[model samples]
Target: MDHVDRTEIRPCRAADLPLLDRHLPTPGAPTRHADRFARQEAGTGTYLLAWRDGVPVGHGQVRWDGCAAPGVRAAVGECPEFNGLDVRAELRGQGIGTALIHAAEELTRERGGTALGLGVGHDNPRAAALYRRLGYGPVVAYTDRWSWTDPDGRTHEEADPCTFLVRDLTTPDA
Candidate 1:
């Protein structure tokens, strides 16, 4: 593992959106990742960033949802406890994303959350492996298929499946 000797955490702001959006998947499908971020910036939820030096390196966000733990009425303003963490392409795998995600999870727990969740395409084994290593586990699996051709004239889709891996906040390692 590479050494990340220095880091800082701050709130996500409008200035970071363009950089963050570039790292996100296309919006062909519906997801609250982008929209919820907008809301967070508008004082709806908590949004934070993890920076290296003076440059933006990673981010974490928290938003409310109607899907809390079982049997309870998940309120709109309740913390859903997920994040769209993006580590800059140049700085990935150096533990930036991991630190950002852990920061979000910690904040969610401080806010009384019992669980935290995030989605990843099943085809992206690299991301899945990272999440798993961080102690998140599969909670929901579903399909989000799409296709795109490359400059090499090849195409692929999300034929495999996608899933949301959740780590319970009340449990250890959360």
Candidate 2:
């Protein structure tokens, strides 16, 4: 038997929130991890967190309804969108992101999504490259819409230039 080393990717739970917040903390803004976990607890969507030796290293979310990318919701209509993907800065290049993406794809497929969609910021070429390497192709160019609250509770909005990508999960190659 060939044994392979793999990071554990699992759904976020209430107890995981603090650790997730510590790992993915936004100093001046409200903790994004907590918000995602809250959404998970509320059943808004499924949020996945990656663990390595009991340490939180990566996170991603799957929204079955729509995506934040301006045209993605309209274009991919009804497909699950992988969102908020991030890995610890120190863990980059360790295949953590890839593992998280694969986990999300599997979950999407299990949920009956025939396609998976995502958006990568124009400024994040490395992530875009990884997405391309993993078989995601550009579907449309649009502004990614999102908002976050500052630590002081002030809400800040953002619209970033991004490219929406999608992969057909129905294909064996995907």
Worst 10 residues of 2 by lDDT: 1-10
Query: Which residue pairs clash within candidate 2?
Result: none
Instruction: List the global CA lDDT of all models.
Output: 0.64, 0.81
Best by lDDT: 2
Q: Which number leads on TM-score?
A: 2
How much is the lDDT of residue 162 in candidate 2?
Answer: 91
Cα lDDT tens digits, model 2, 1-174, are 211155788999889877876777766555677777777777767899889878888889988676855477677776788888988898798888888888888988897878888899999999999999989999888887777777678888988899889988888643
**True lDDT of residue 103, candidate 1:** 75
lDDT of 1: 0.64
Q: Which pairs clash (backbone N, Cα, C closer than 3 Å) in model 1?
A: none
